[model samples]
Target: MIDEEYAKLLKQAELDYEDNKKFIMVLKKIRAKSLDREFNMLHDKAFEEIDCLKCGNCCRTVRPIYQQKDITKLAKRFHCRPIVWEKEYTDVDEDNDRIAKTVPCPFIAEDNYCIYYEDKPKFCRDYPYTDKTRLRNYLRETMENSKICPAVYLMINWLKESVNRGTLS
Candidate 1:
């Protein structure tokens, strides 16, 4: 069953997306320190309230873009050649960069847990992309992610509320 709060948050996020593009653009240009402070504050508050493990929607639906470093590390951990691992578990994306081919990543177990949780890529470890360096593009990408990941929807809702309340202003 869908959590009612999740549904409400998703609706609010959609509404905010339509109504607050300007706010988003303006926030994108705000100083990195200010944005980081606000993002960290909001992230802490939202994480305290939302349990991602309960949903695991992001894990089930989205694939992180794996860097060469990530591939090398994972390959070493699995005791396999990077080329072999890439062939079996991933594919070249449009940019001809190696990325996971399947959603719910091949390494994620049936119980919705990561088999390589500790060794997961930095992008996976920092899913939803909240860093100030790519905050704007991340937010834009998150709008698409929201359709599949409840956590992204929740984060976007929380961000919208923070902006509305002037906490991020």
Candidate 2:
């Protein structure tokens, strides 16, 4: 089970950042300094404390924006034509990007396992995008995800503290 304290922290972080970008420049510098090792440490610690099976919030709330290749692959997995799959399962978002039809993600099993786990899209596989090498490049994306993923919430909290302490400089 995920400790509720972390969930509360996520909520607090959401509240703190929704209207502020005070940390954005520090975040960029941290990322630009190639502090992947520091981030990887924080990232690993967060995941050690949080379990995804207990909280598949990302799958529960976010839609995977589909690439053409993702569409084709999913169609193949379902043994249907890409056009047919596209018609039934996707819609164009306001940005004209193709996103999945379902909000909670149609592929999530009752137990929170992705039904299409093995054949899922790259976006799904890369959800939260924290462990990448140059994590600074994904600072905006990580900030957005911090609200939903406890691991991200914890990682960001640590990163902020580290930045202020000059330990990460």
Candidate 3:
């Protein structure tokens, strides 16, 4: 029961996989400050058209990394100790990072509303990390995320258009 837009996004992402990597390389050559400004602007523009509730692809596809404070916060919400919460809900990944045990995110409801949005992990809150500074540092992650996030896909495409049009260099 995926929305048509989401379906299209998935297909487009798959098809653009190679191009996205090249785009990331192109981004690497841009001045970091200029790239950050353009990405921040396009990130805002993409969100204005992309309603996340309609397409919780990232929540469905990626596990949020959990910090100790995140565990404590959600544990208090569930009236449990941080240790209990961590044991029940998280697992140490191969990289030794604590990540959510489930995909589709346990915090996300059927309607795609976050059950504990305010208390969600910083990683979840940050999501794609397109708006943050140090754009060059996040290029690899952002390139990967474009496939999963329509806003990112759109932002990347918009930036590509700008580049092709000579508006961005």
Candidate 4:
């Protein structure tokens, strides 16, 4: 069960999701080139004070897409074939993306440490994708992630505010 305050925050993020997408679309047209730098700064600042162990919302709610390499590696870790691993741990989404089958991924421990942290998927290693190069290209994913990761939510809000203030332009 979610606490009331956090649940309300999630509700607000859900309400903002579509609007964030639209904002990204606009950003692409006008501010694509400089987005990476601004986003990297925001990502660093957000993470500096935010301890993810305190809120494992991303592991709880987001389904990470698994790459073929991830599938093979994890399969080996589990002493299984990739096909068997996929069948047991993953599912295909509407986009035909191979994502984790469970919410609150089975590998996430109760203390918010990933049981498979060292061998975690590439996507998991680079989650939220805000600090990556070509931030504009991943805006859609970032917007979706904002709903689950508070750091991302804060980054997105800060980004919008910076743009509005002409600081990120």
Residue 120 in model 1: lDDT: 89
Task: Kindly give the number of clashing pairs for every candidate.
Answer: 0, 0, 0, 0
Output the number of the lDDT-best candidate.
Answer: 3
Candidate 2 local lDDT, 1-169, one digit each (tens):
3346755866787797763355767776654545788877887788888878767778877889999989998999989999999999999999999998988888887777888788788888877777778776777777788887878887877877888788887
lDDT of 3: 0.89
How good is model 3 by TM-score?
A: 0.96
Off-target runs (Cα >4 Å) in candidate 4 are: 1-11, 18-22
Please give each candidate's TM-score: 0.76, 0.85, 0.96, 0.84
Q: Clash pairs of candidate 4?
A: none
Report lDDT (CA) for all predictions: 0.68, 0.79, 0.89, 0.84
Candidate 1 lDDT over 3-71, as tens digits, reads 567556666666666544455676676666777676666666666776665556667667777888888
In model 3, the clashing pairs are none
Which ranges in model 3 have alpha carbons more than 4 Å from their true place? none
Q: At residue 5, give the lDDT of candidate 4.
A: 53
TM-score between model 2 and native: 0.85
